[model samples]
Target: MKEKQVLIVGLGLIGASLALAIKKEHPNTRIIGLDVQKESEAFALKRGMIDEIAESLDLAAPEADVILLCSPVEAVKKQLQIISRIPLKESVILSDAGSTKSEIVDLAETLGLENFIGGHPMAGSHKSGVTAGDERLFENAYYIFTPGKPKDQKRIKALQSLLAGTQAKFVVMSTEEHDKITGLLSHLPHVIAAGLVNQSKAFNKEHPGAGRLAAGGFRDITRIASSDPVMWTDILLSNKETLLGLLDNWRGEMDQVSEWIAAENREAIFQFFYEAKETRNQMPIHKEGVIPAFHDLFIDVPDVPGVIAEVTGIIGKANLSLINLKILETREDIFGILQLTFKRKEDLERAKECIEKETDYLWYEK
Candidate 1:
């Protein structure tokens, strides 16, 4: 195989992480990076994502064997316009990290590009930017490849090899399928999260009393709404058509719940709740030999020194790793609750037994 020179056209988290994964996997291949923001370039360079940073793509386009455009969807579309007309090395295989692909694929076809591949990694955090770059972010994540037809098989093999460190299974999907499915699973969630936060705030303003009691649960659920609104707005707009379909489907379910409550159909409401619980229970277990599911185990402790310490000690002694913990310090709330995470049913049972045996703490949430 010929020695490779890879050019990463953006210095965001996705781009920098991809650079790091490629560097770790292919040390023989030199990586070049270009970003519009000077701070982003500096951060990516300091993090050692790219071996050298370029001032312009024009200066760096000629040498790359693989070129990754990891800019935003709109930005990627515009960059592809400029990139396709550039004096790129004829053998360079181009791939993109845009979340949306229909618009990008259209742009590529418009530019008459033959070796371009559309891609998305199914791992994104609420975090952003070059400073948020973590090499292991893509580890065990799914990477979807929407390769254009008539692509060189060698290029496909080379691109796949470059991403070997991601532990990402590269599944091939058409550009249209990728957009529609993602708009449902990925994009729709952001839309709903943001909308829920907005609707809650609007209701609070009208009711006024609800604002006084925005509890830990509401705060936790709405945390995704705190993510950059500009990014969410851009995604929602770019994937509007498919998102509308998802929104309508979600509304249909919401309408059923509303009708059941209005008619005082307790049986139907309880049945719906039961079905939801059952469906959630069957999810994949993150812990080996255990069912994958999210369950709430709430322990109440008095507001005193070492209360949190004493509670966690029982959990640790019982050998259960807490996945997430939050302490609420709001006034008028007497006891603090600890929501523990355990992979196995055995661990949950053990922790419950240990707490019941060793401590006088009250279990409030099941």
Candidate 2:
């Protein structure tokens, strides 16, 4: 078979990771990269993420079997415009890793590009740039596709084959469906997190000690607020309609809670909390369908030397690797709460049991 050529425009985390994954799986495939930053191209080449740099879509798109736009949402739209003017291979398939799908998909359709599909990998890190890219970044994550035609199954399958190394679960849905769904899950959460952080900043400016007294839970909830402002700004503008509607829905939910509190309706408040707990607990703890889940164990342990090492040693001795382990909440006067995350349920269960049996600490599956 003739070696397939993949042209990745932009060498940011997602673009570089895709290139690395493809090269790892199919070393014979010709991987071409296009980026405005020459340094990114150099970095990707040195790390074997891409075979060569094309410099522009005009040179790359014509020879590419698959072209991936891994730029921010606004840039993805501009690239689509450029792709519309460029002469591409008849069989060339185009896609993107943009967060907003409706705009990109609509633009592709308007451009009369039959081979273009919109895709978003529902996974990312707070880290950015080529140096942060990892081949396993997309493993077990959901990869959503919004194709122009339902019968574009062959093209979808071809694209999937090219990205087989990602190990991502494929999901096909309409552009509108994707926007609404992601707006609720990803976009809205970012808005809320940023709002909370901004609220804290305003309060701290007046109170003067609030920021210094902030704890782990506050940082954890507002972690997403530290994301790149430029990238998030583009995403929010692109998905404005869906996000606004979601915000209104969230406001309604908050108003109901406020009313219950004002009325001193204990049963209503208890029922609300109980129902929310029940619903949240029913969510899958392992990667399934479009959701990427976590297996976490929360433990309360004393603050002392070797405490972390001792806890990790037990899991390590059991031959179980942790995805992430951290002291989520700690205070000088109170027992610290440690949270351990594992990629597998069996590993999580084993870690919980190991910690419970080895120490006099309290532990539970989170």
Candidate 3:
């Protein structure tokens, strides 16, 4: 097969990452990047992310077999406008990493770009810019494809083929479906997190020591509040209608909680929490939808010295590498649960065997 030329519009985290991933998997594939920031082009070039930096869209779009727009939601619209006016080859397949898909897909349709396939790789870090780009950023992540038309499968497949190096699981859905679900799953969460942080800030102003008391749960839930403010602001506004509906639903739920608290309905409150916990527990921790399933082992270990080291040593001797290790639970004079995360299921199975054979440790798959 002839090597496909991929043109990336923005050289930020996602764009630079796609470049590196493609370079790693398909070295012969030519990557052309275009960004407003000269430093980003230099950084990606220095890192061998792109074969060449297109000085302009005129230079890039015409030659590209695949065009990936990885800019902010608003900027994506502008880039689309620019690309629409450009005389490009009909074979060029355009995809985007925008958070909201409805507008982008509609814009592509309006621009008569039949080959444009809207995509969002559902993975990223709070960190931004080309410097934070990693080849494995999209590994085991969901790559959503919201095509402008149902029959644009060929173009979608070609775009996916170009992004094969990212190792993301492809999910096909309509643009409206993508927007509504993402509005709830992603955009609304950011809004809620920011609201919670603001509420905490206000409380801390009235009670100076309140800020110092935020630990574990508060910190975990609000971690996304530290995300790029400008980017999030654009996202929040872009998905305003769907987010507004979510806000109303959230308000209704909060009102129910308030009513329960006022009435002192202990059983009702307990039931509410019970149902929520049950539903949350049912959510898939390990990827099951095309993305590679995670191999995690949760072990209950005694809160004593040498026990963790002993377990780790046993696994180490078996030549199984742990991707992540976390003490899930710990308390005074109590057995703690340790969670071990691995990249491959075979490693997890090996670790399980080693644990059962070498020690009497109680463990279960996560």
Candidate 4:
């Protein structure tokens, strides 16, 4: 039997991570990669994320048993068109890691690619590029597949077998269902976050202190706004119709809230927030979903020179890693709140135990 050859296009975070994950599980399987950015391709090759750099898609597609388009939605669509022109192996399973799937699935059907599957791995980092690739990036995350036809089940299973190394939970849904869910859970949130940031920017121009004052809560919610603007623009445009409807609904929601405030309807306002809090509190905290969960532990430490180092020293001594650390609220007179972020729940739990054992400081999980 021939050794499996997987071709990965776009050597960014998702692409590089996917390649690394595949290599980790199937060391003998040859991985070929192509990226528009020469540096990304070189980086992936040097880092052993890919076995070889493909000369072109046309040259690579015919040889690949599995082909994954890991680019932005628009780029994925263009690549689909390109791949449609190229002759692929009879058993080749084509898929993509685009966030939005409806348009891509429609395009695949239109292009006569019967074996193509629309995939979105619901996991990511704020960081991008090949340098940020990690083999465990998709571990325990949902990998949704939108197969265009009933007959594509065998091919979908084949693709899943190839990607089993990712350790992502597989989910199958219709393209329409996938789009509507993602538009609400992912794309719509990004749009709202960006809109909030822009509105704050306009306000900051009129009031200089406004931006600085918008720190903890505002920064937390708008963090996704800092994502790659070009990528978000492509995603928002690709799911324009769904987002348009969502935004219309969002406007109606805002109008209701505005009226509540205007009419001084205290009970209505309280019920609104009460329902939102109840719904939000019911969401699974530790599970990785469409949005990444932050396993954060907050420590209250003295506002002194060595306090941060002392806390970090404890975590480091235990051979634990922190995703990020920030001083949320600090003052000379009061204990400073230090935020420690972990990628996994186990790490967070272990870090908490270490902090408790090693320090006298008070810590809490939020």
Candidate 5:
């Protein structure tokens, strides 16, 4: 039997990642990439991610056993056009990495792809482009699939087989459920982040020193707002029904907060915070769980120039491996917290001890 062929369309982070992942997990599959950017195609080839790179989908589509559509949420229409135009000899599994599922799933249904599933991996960084691609990005992330039809189960399994190496948890949900749940947990938060950044900027414009006071808390909360604006706008609009409903609920909650503050009800304010904190404490979330590493060192340092460089220098001198570091503040008044993850737990401990000896920063191992 001939080896299976997987065609990946688009060569951005997600597409490049899918190509690398599928090639790694299912080495038997012949991976081929179709990218609009010829330079990206050449890069993918040089990286050995794909067996070959096609200049167009017209040349690659018909030969693929599976088509991984990795276009942005806003480009679902163009993806549908490409899928619809493909002339596969056999029924090929068509799947995507689009964030909002309802619209894309509906479009896929209309386009007549036999085995269409809309997938959204709850994994990403505040970065884009081919260079940001990592095969392990989906590890431990929730990969949701919205099946086009009941008969697409086999195709779903096939996709799962290819991703088995990533160790992601597979979740099957209806398009509506996927949109509503993701909008509440994922989409709504991004909107709030953007709103917060805007509010902070406006405040800084009026009160000149206000921006200087915002420390780690502000940057941590507003980080998601730095993501691709066009992509987020497309997602928010695409899932308007779910997002608007969430926004309405959030508005009511905000009103309650405002009302309590206006009344000068300290007890009510405390109660609101206590209850919210208790709720958050129950969630299966950790500081390093989503964005940070599982085994990491966290430090609280007084916000000062050259403090980060000094700490990193200490750790580097110790020869400890650093996986990634997040600097939570860029201001001078307030102290900053440094969250560092290491490749090994031993390195984490070594880095922690080394950094602790250098600065007045208190350290905690998380």
Candidate 6:
């Protein structure tokens, strides 16, 4: 095949990263990026994330072999409508990196864009924008495709080939399946995380010390609450029906737990927790899925100067890389807790061994 021209709209994190990954693997292929944010376009071009910056969809749509809509769900819907009116090439494969699929797929079908295929790359970070784009963001992640028609296998394969540079595991399913699964796994979690955060805020108003007492576990569980609210608001609204169903089921589960507690059934509560632990423990830890997992190690250290540097120095000397690190709590006289995050379990273990061998600090993994 001749060199492919890929046009990515919305040069945000996913769009810019896709451009970089494609360029890294297929240098001959041309990537054209377009975004409403002029700085994002300039940044992607200056960093060589894209070969060309499109002035408008009208001028770029015709030349693209593939067009990827990588904006927020609502923005993507508007782009699809605009692209529907644009005169695209006959062989152009249209797709998106949106979280939800059903609504987008329905819109495409309604617009008579038979070549449109729905895509959702199950990978992301808490960060946003072109600056945060990383070529390796989709590495080992699940890239799902939800094609609306049965006769689009050839187009699907071509689109897959175009995205092969991501090194993501590809899975195929229907739009319904994609929405329902993601609603339960991704959307519902965000709702619950935000709910928990709001609940904690209300509780903190009544008891000021409650917020300070929120430790590692609470922070970890509610981390998604820190995501871009506008983007998540669009996502939750787009998948409203699926989320409503999931929320109903979630409420029933909560009610059952409440009933168990009210009855003072010790065995029931014990079994509930035991079953939950077993199910959670059985989940795959190494694989990158819809939800990202953090491998964290907590260390107790004195609140003295160079104490943070000392622990990091030990890990660095062992050549172990940390994804992130922070001091969860520190006081003038009390020993502070330092949290170090690793990308893999092996690295976490190696860092722990290195720290123990070099220092007298007490450490535990979460």
> Tens digit of lDDT per residue, candidate 2, span 1-366?
899999999899999999988887888999999888899999999888888889568877888999999999999999899899998989889999998898999899899888998999877764689998888778888999899865489899998888899988989999999989888877888889999999998999899878866655687567678788998899889999998889899999999999999999999999999999999789765653333345778889888778899998998999987767778767786899888877556678888788878888898764
- RMSD, one per candidate, in order: 5.4, 3.2, 4.2, 1.2, 3.9, 2.5
Instruction: Provide the clash count, candidate 1.
Output: 2
List candidate 5 segments past 4 Å from native.
287-296, 300-362
Cα lDDT of model 5 by residue, 91-184, tens digit: 6888888889999888878887767878876677545777777787677677888997664788789889987866678888899888888888
TM-score of 1: 0.80
Please give, for residues 92-184, the per-residue lDDT of candidate 6 as tens digits.
Answer: 899999999999999999999999999998888766899988887888889999999774899889988888889889899998999998898
lDDT of 1 by residue, 1-366 (tens): 777889999888789888888888878888899999998988777878888898688778877888899888878888888888788877779989888888887779789888788888766554688887767666556688887765456766878888997766677788889888878766777677778888888999789987756756786566556666665676778788888888899999999999999999999999999998999789654422101133456787677778778888878776676646666552344876667755345667778889999988877544
* Candidate 3 positional error at 144, Å: 1.0
lDDT tens digits, residue span 1-366, model 4: 888999999999999999988888889999999999999999999989999999999899999999999999999999999999998999889999999988999999999999899999999986789999989899999999999976588888887888889999999999889989989998899889989999999999999998787987798778888889899899889888999999999999999999999999999999999999999999887999898777889999999889998999999998987878888988878898999988888899999899888889999988
- How much lDDT does each candidate structure score? 0.77, 0.85, 0.84, 0.91, 0.78, 0.89
Better of 1 and 4 by TM-score: 4
In model 4, the runs with Cα more than 4 Å from the true position are none
Question: Model 4 shows how many backbone clashes?
Answer: 0
Provide the global lDDT of candidate 2 against the true structure.
0.85
Q: Which of candidates 2 and 4 is the stronger one according to TM-score?
A: 4
TM-score of each: 0.80, 0.87, 0.81, 0.97, 0.85, 0.91
Model 2 spans > 4 angstroms off: 288-302, 309-325, 328-335, 340-363
Candidate 5 pairs with clashing backbones: 303-335
Score residue 318 of candidate 6 by CA lDDT.
85
Q: Arrange candidates by TM-score, highest first: which order?
A: 4, 6, 2, 5, 3, 1
Model 4, residue 227: C-alpha shift (Å): 1.0
Best by lDDT: 4
